[model samples]
Target: MFAQIRWRLLLSYLTVFTSILVIFAAGVRLLFARSLTQQLTDRLTALGQGAATNAEFDNGRLKVESDFIVQQLIHKNQGLEWFNLNQKSILKQGNIGLNLPLSLSKSPIQFSNKNFNIQAVVVPIISNDNGKIIGYIRVSQSLEEVDETLTKLDLILGSSIIIALIFSGFSGVILTRQAMQPIEESFQRLKQFTADASHELRSPLMAIKSNAAVALKYPEKMRKSDVEKFQAIVSAANQMTHLTEDLLLLARSEKKCDRRENSVNLTAILSNLLSLYQPEATAKEIDLKSETGEDMYLLGNAGQLTRLFANLIENALHYTLSGGTVEVTANLVRSYLIVSVQDTGAGIAPEHIKLVFERFWRADESRSYWKGGSGLGLAIAKTIAQNHGGSITLTSQVGVGSCFTVRLPSVKISDNSQD
Candidate 1:
């Protein structure tokens, strides 16, 4: 159980940490890309404005002087284009290795060409004399270096996230173990107390029951009131004895041990249990039946498996009304041996179904207690099923009936092995 808890804690920690890393990485990438692009746009806009100054309208036609100012604008990894107001490119400078449309923006506008991996900006030239639009200047630069740097940053961030998650996984395991230590210790102490208390109570309870039985055996020598009182004593002692036995069984079941070496004949076990309960069913006028094939086998402790099914059958019979039916069936479905104890009884309520297997929990507490049930029968049965690498489930309707099904891994037994 603690192992499962530790793994869950580690998985949750890794999930939260990974999400934070991803969000942080995305934010960092966006900010860095925006800053780099802004720097590039600013440089391009400055160059375009400077080059636009040298451009003049001659005879109502735009012309740019190829002087040092325009030449300086066409630096390494940069290009320039001057277009007239008619949106026609008249001059190109340096290596503008992309076929792009003329820029017609009145203000500095930045754009990119994915095919050429380039960033560029356009600025409209205004006449200094009359403040009329005359021409446009476009400046461009390669984005190969910027893209390379971003890619490197992405790689580093991804690697760091992976490393950090690995470290957090280790740290989470240690932290969960430390957190679980006290709870585990407390559980061990409680289990030990139960086992010890149950063991200590057994002697007194048995002695009381036996002495009461001995006293009742000689009814001739005792008053009628004394006889009834002794009978009640015997009954109470029996109930307490059963309760302590159940508690001790549950306490001992917590130990992790292998019980798979013994091969139990499931068919024989069921047949014997049905026979044992046949008298009680007959007394109640209940139609108790069994539908099972021969030679069903499973690997488990026979006594424990017997007790597991006995609890189900007994509980079924206890709740069943006179003239009702209780059926026990066993079959091999695929690799599992399916056993069901179905009873046509006052079925469980939907709301109380989940709490049925909780130790000391009863759907109708007063009635269940009066009926001589310790309320740990189903809980012990569930524990036994789980310990044997099996499971038990219930399906019921309030007005109809209840079916308790047990699924255990089936095993094949040869004739020689059985012999």
Candidate 2:
């Protein structure tokens, strides 16, 4: 249980760490991208403004000075295009094309082609004499280098996040284990106390029950009221004894231990249990029967296995209505033996299914009390199945019946060998 808790804690830590790292990386990437884009846009706007300075209207036609174009060609990736006020291209310089359209808007407008993305700004040339629009200058640059730099930044951030997560995963395991140590110690101490207390109470409980039984054996010597009092004492002691025994079993089962024992035949065990329960079924007028294969064997303690199935059977019989069916079936599938106890009973609600195996959890509380159930039967059965490297599952509906299936790893034996 502590191991399971540690794993869950470590997973939660890693999940939260990964989320924060991803968000931080994304924020860094977004800010860096925006800063680089802003720098490109500013450079384009400045170049377009400078080109607009050298513009002049000659004979109502726009023209740009040759000196400005020559000086601006030093920039390798930069491009420029000039257009007359009529929106016709006047000149193309550097790497820009004449096919580029004129833009009256002062802000940068982005364009993309098969080769690369372009960031451009348009500057409208106003006549110095009359302040009338004369021409337009478009300055642009390719975004290849900026894209390459950002790609490299992405790679670096991604690799860093992965490495950090790998390291954090290792540390998370250690941290979660350290964190759970106190809780684990406390749980172990509680189990020890329960085992010790249950063991200590057994003798006194049995003695009280025995003394009450002996006193009741000679009922004529006592008044009728005293006889009733002794009978009540015997019943109370028996209940306490059963409760203590269950508590002790649960406490012991919680301790990790190897459970492999002698080979046990499941078929014979179920047969015996069926015979034992047959009289109760007859009295209740319920149909209790077994449909099982022969010589189904598993490596486990015979007593524990018997107790596991007995609990299931008793639980089924207790809930089932008179004339309802309780069927115990066993079948071999692959290397596992599947045994199921199905009952046509007052089926458990869907919400209560998960709580069925919890210690002292009863679906029908008042009915279980009247039926003398301590509410630990299913829990004990689950513990025993888990100890033997098996699992038990339940399937039920409210109006239909319920099935409790136990799947255990089966063993094969030769004819000459004795179990």
Candidate 3:
């Protein structure tokens, strides 16, 4: 359980962190790419304008002046290439070299190859007298610097993400362990208390039973009323025994453990339990009925299911007054088996319905021992349902009765021969 909790915490942290990292990386790449492209385009435009101004029309022949322009066009170790419209190589700057075609009619093209990107611009130069194009200039710039900067940025971002993930993973595991410590301690304490309490209670109960038996041994010397009182003492001790057992069972159920799986016939279990309780219902003048669909099969522990039903039925019997009705019904609903126990008893208040299933929580503080309840019945039933991948819900009104429903995944029979 602790391992599962830790893993879940780690996964949650990683999911959130990775999502933000991905968004940040994408945004940075896009913004940097846009900024670099704009800077390159601006530089190319400036170079093209300067070159156009330096070229002059002298007797119908283009004469390029300006020593600075000539020097820039021939500079070595720089990344710039230039070509004239007549497909003749003009001035070339930088170590990078390129070949030009004479009959070029295409416009400027910007393309990236491998790690280096190139931006080419074509500009037309006009004649001095008319608006006719004398020639065109093409300039290209290399994007090696931008590529290197972006690569460094990517490394920094990746490193930061890795460091953050390591820190978060460590923190998540520590926090998960700390959070579960109290829960583990509580479970241990509860288990030890149940064991010690059960053992302590058994001694007194056995003594009482022994004393009652001894009193009956000298029945001839005792009054009829005295013998009857002793019998009542024995009966009360037995009831206490039952209550202790139920309490222990509830405590064990609360501790998480795998339940044994077996094929359970809901209809059979309900029918048998109902039959066993029929006499009690008749004696109390209450109507008890069972409505079960044919062969409702489920996969769960049979013992837990029996106990679940017993507790619900017993609770219904205890609250319902004489001449009231208690009903038990089971059927298959789609992929689930639904069982409902309803009674015409003093129904739970709307506000208390949610708390009724909590351990040792009783709505009536003045509930008597004669009812033979320890207030753990509903809690046990809930735990059993949950362990079986199911749930229990309650609906009640103050004056009207209450209905407790249990829904569990149903097992499909290979053949529907027996409906």
Candidate 4:
């Protein structure tokens, strides 16, 4: 149980942490990539536009206004080239070795050469006097530095994520363990109190019954009032003893040693339960029936499984009115052995149905407690079923009766090694 709790706690924390980290990392990387590309494009576009503006058509020949384009290319590591409308280069700098076709495209275009990976924009040169095309200017910027920076940023994010996960795994497990300490301590205290209280009550209860029995031996010499008093004390002590035993059983149900198991034939068990309750059913004028199959076997502790079914049948017969019907059925369904105890009696209301298996929870929605129940029978049955790797479920309507179904993993004939 603690192992399961620990893993669940760690996984839950890591799920949220990893998701946030992944989203934040991706978001930051995306923003950085966009900003880098935009700044580079903007710088290349401004230089291309300035070069285009410096050209002029002088007496039917295109000519630059000054050495402005050459000055901008020096020491900047940016490629600058001028092209006539005939797609021929006029001025080339920064040792650009490619003779690409002329393009009047405003967007940045990327190309690679031996010296640099370049992003260039082609700005159109228009004659202000005639509003016609004259020539073009191409400005290119090197992307080596930008690529190196982004590569370093990616490596840092990847390394950080790996380290964070490793450290968080260990720390998350330890922190979760510390968080569960209070619950573990409270559970231990509850079990201790139950065991100690039952032990304490049993001793005094035995003494009271022993003294009462001694007094009862002299009933002939005593008045009616004294006999009644002793009888009451003995009866009360017996009741208290039974209650204490039940409490002890509930407390120890989860112990590993108490769950020592063997193959048990549920068919025989159900038959035995039916036979045991037959007389009570007959006296109450109720119809008790069993439709159990033979050799319906399962692996479980015999005593606990017996108690599980016994409690269900007992409750069914207890709440059943005279002339009502109580049925116990056992059958094998696929890999599971199913046992159901159904009664035609006062049923549970919808509001209280979910609380049937809760400890000490009795349904008082429409019924009274005249049919004396300890209210722990179903709770004990539920625990025993779970300990045996089984489950118990219920189906009931308020006016109609309730059915409690238990499913246990069936023992197959192929597993006859236990025989």
Candidate 5:
């Protein structure tokens, strides 16, 4: 149970951490790509404008006069090329014609080929007077740099997720162990108490039973009052026997040492349990009913399930008054098998509702002696549900009634059924 809780905590942490990291990584990648693309485009546009402005039409040839400007443009823009309108490259260096368009068009043209990590943008240099096409200035840049940056970002994000998962997993295990330590210690103490209490009660109970038997054997010599006293002793001893049995059951439940898997027909089990409890309900004049779905099978310990339901039903019967109703329903809903026990009894108080499931907790202190309850019923039920990868919850109103619902994952009928 502690391990399960810890795993759930770890998974929750992982989900949240992965979600945030993925969103952040995507955002960063998008911004970086956009910024880089825009910077490249702006630089290309500026160079194209410069080339147009610096063009000088002398006779029939266009001449670029500024040596400093040409050197700056070529050196700074390493991967860009300048080309003429006749599909001829002017700059012979740095892979030129890759950007120059095949068709003569005035509009800016952009193209990319991811195989080579190459991107190209071409713009025509138009004459200012007649708006006629003069020459073309093409700009191209390698996407290798961008790819490298993104790869690094991926590595960083991946490493962070792995590190966080490791740390959280370790922390979750430690925290879970610490949290369960007190509970384990409490259970140990409870076990010792049960053993001691049982041993202490046994001697007195045996003595009483033995004396009662001796008196019965010599009934002729005993007075009527003495017989009556012996009968009372026998009755008390019987009650003590029942109490000891309940205590042992509770102790075994607390230990939770048994874990065997077996296929069990849940519907059949519920039906049988309802049948067994019917007589008790009739004695109290409380209506006990069972509604089970068809062929609801699951893999679990039948003994544990029986104990779980017995505790719940017994508690319900104990609390409920005559003419009240107790209902048990089982059904398969989606992937879960749900079992609900509802009772129209002296409903739990709002304040005591939460504490009712705790060990040795009783809402009605006045009826504690009459009920003959050790107050470990609901706790045992809860433990059983959890052991089966299930959960139990309660809802109650003071004047109305209380409902205890248990939901467990459905299992196949063909699976191992040793439990």
Candidate 6:
């Protein structure tokens, strides 16, 4: 049981960690990209502004005073161009062409020229003396280098994310294990207490019941009060015995033991269990019957399956009144084996339906103790079903009958296979 809980804890930790990491990584990537783009645009703007200073408008024509120096300033890294106010390119240098953006924008833009995709910025020049608009200077750089750098960054970030996920998964397991230590210890202590209590209590209970039986058998030699006292002791011991046996079973369920892989026939196990309870039903004037369809097969522990059904059937029989009908049925429903133990008894109240499977919980606290109900039967059934990767549910009404359905995983085996 703890093993299952452990894995679930591990997965939950991984899921939360992964979600947080992914969000952080995405934010980092987006911020990094925007920063890089802004840095490139700032560089282009600086160059474009500087180049505009060396330009002038002469005789209604654009001219540059230092063409060679401007070429040297641009170097081989970027393209430079000058455009007239009419949106026509006056001069092209470096890796640029006559093709430019539709307007001169202070911000950088992506544009395609004859040869490359360029990140460029355009700045308009005004004659300082006349305050008239002259021409615009466009400065640009090819995006191949920026693309290469960003690609390398992506690879680094991707590698970091993968490594972090693996580390988190490994560390999460260890951390979750350490965190659950207290719970595990508590369960171990409880199991030990149950084992010790059952072992210690059984001997005295057996002794008391044995002495009571012996005394009651020879009632002629005893007073009426003595006989009554022995009978009470016998009854109390029997109830204690049932409670202890149930505790022992619950403790066994705590261990994560490897289950049997052999196939068990549902039809046979239910049939045998039904036959064993038939006499009790007969004595109560109840009709006990089976509506089993076929001998469905499954891979599981036969003993546990037997006990699981036994608890359900016994509970049904106990709750049902005289002349009630207790029915057992099983069949294959897709991937599950639906086995139901139904009874036409005084059904459970709607409000108490959910509490039926709780350990030691009884709907009617004042009911007779002689009914032999320790209130752990449905709880045991629930544990067994869940441990087997199955489930049990109860449906009841105030005055109508009750039905307890158990769904277990089913399998098929050849006739010659081992039991």
Off by over 4 Å in 1: 65-121, 128-148, 211-233, 279-289, 319-327, 342-355, 364-371, 393-403, 415-419
The digit string of per-residue lDDT tens for model 6 on 1-419 reads 67779899999888887888778878887888788889888888877777888888889887776444546645656878878888887677774553635576656788665665678788877786687779888877887677777788788878988899899888888888898899999988988998889878889889988988988999999999998898899988898999998888877765543445577888899989988998999999999999998778877777878889999888888878788899888889998999998888778788888898888888773223336777787888888888777889988866568899999888766732548
Cα lDDT for residue 176, model 2? 90
TM-score of 4: 0.64
Order of all candidates by lDDT, from best down to worst?
2, 1, 4, 6, 3, 5
User: 1-419, model 2: which lDDT tens digit per residue?
Assistant: 57778898899999999999999999999999999999988888777777788889888688678566444563657878888878888788887553656777767787896798878888888888899889888877888889999999999999999999999999999899889999988988988998999999999998999899999999999999999999999989988999999889888776544545478889999999999999999999999988996888888778788989999999899888898999999999999999999998878888989999998887773235245877788898998898888999999888677999999988876522335
lDDT of 3 by residue, 304-366 (tens): 889999999988888888899999998889989999999988787778888999877887722
Kindly report the root-mean-square deviation of model 4 from the true structure over all alpha carbons: 7.7
TM-score of each predicted structure versus truth: 0.78, 0.89, 0.56, 0.64, 0.54, 0.69
Error of 5 at 370 (Å): 4.3
Error of 6 at 419 (Å): 7.7
lDDT of all the models against the reference? 0.85, 0.85, 0.76, 0.82, 0.73, 0.80
lDDT of 1 by residue, 240-282 (tens): 9999999998887757536556788989989999999999999
Local error of candidate 2 at residue 391 (angstroms): 2.1
Error of 2 at 23 (Å): 1.2
**Candidate with best lDDT:** 2
- Expressed as tens digits, the lDDT of each residue in 1-419 for candidate 4 is 56678899899999989998888888988899789989988887887777777789887777877456454565576777887777678877764445777776666788887766877888777888897878887877778778788899899888888789889999998899999988888988988899889989998899999999998998999999999989989988887887788788888775642323467777888888888999999999999998986677777787888999999999898877889999988888899988999998789987787899988788775347343566778988988898888899998887678899999888864564332
Clash totals in order: 0, 0, 2, 0, 4, 0
Worst 10 residues of 5 by lDDT: 92-101
For model 1, what is the alpha-carbon lDDT of residue 110?
Answer: 44
Q: Which portions of model 6 show Cα errors greater than 4 Å?
A: 60-81, 86-105, 110-118, 128-133, 142-144, 174-186, 205-239, 253-264, 275-290, 296-303, 314-328, 332-375, 382-419
Candidate 5 residue pairs that clash? 261-419, 262-417, 262-418, 263-417
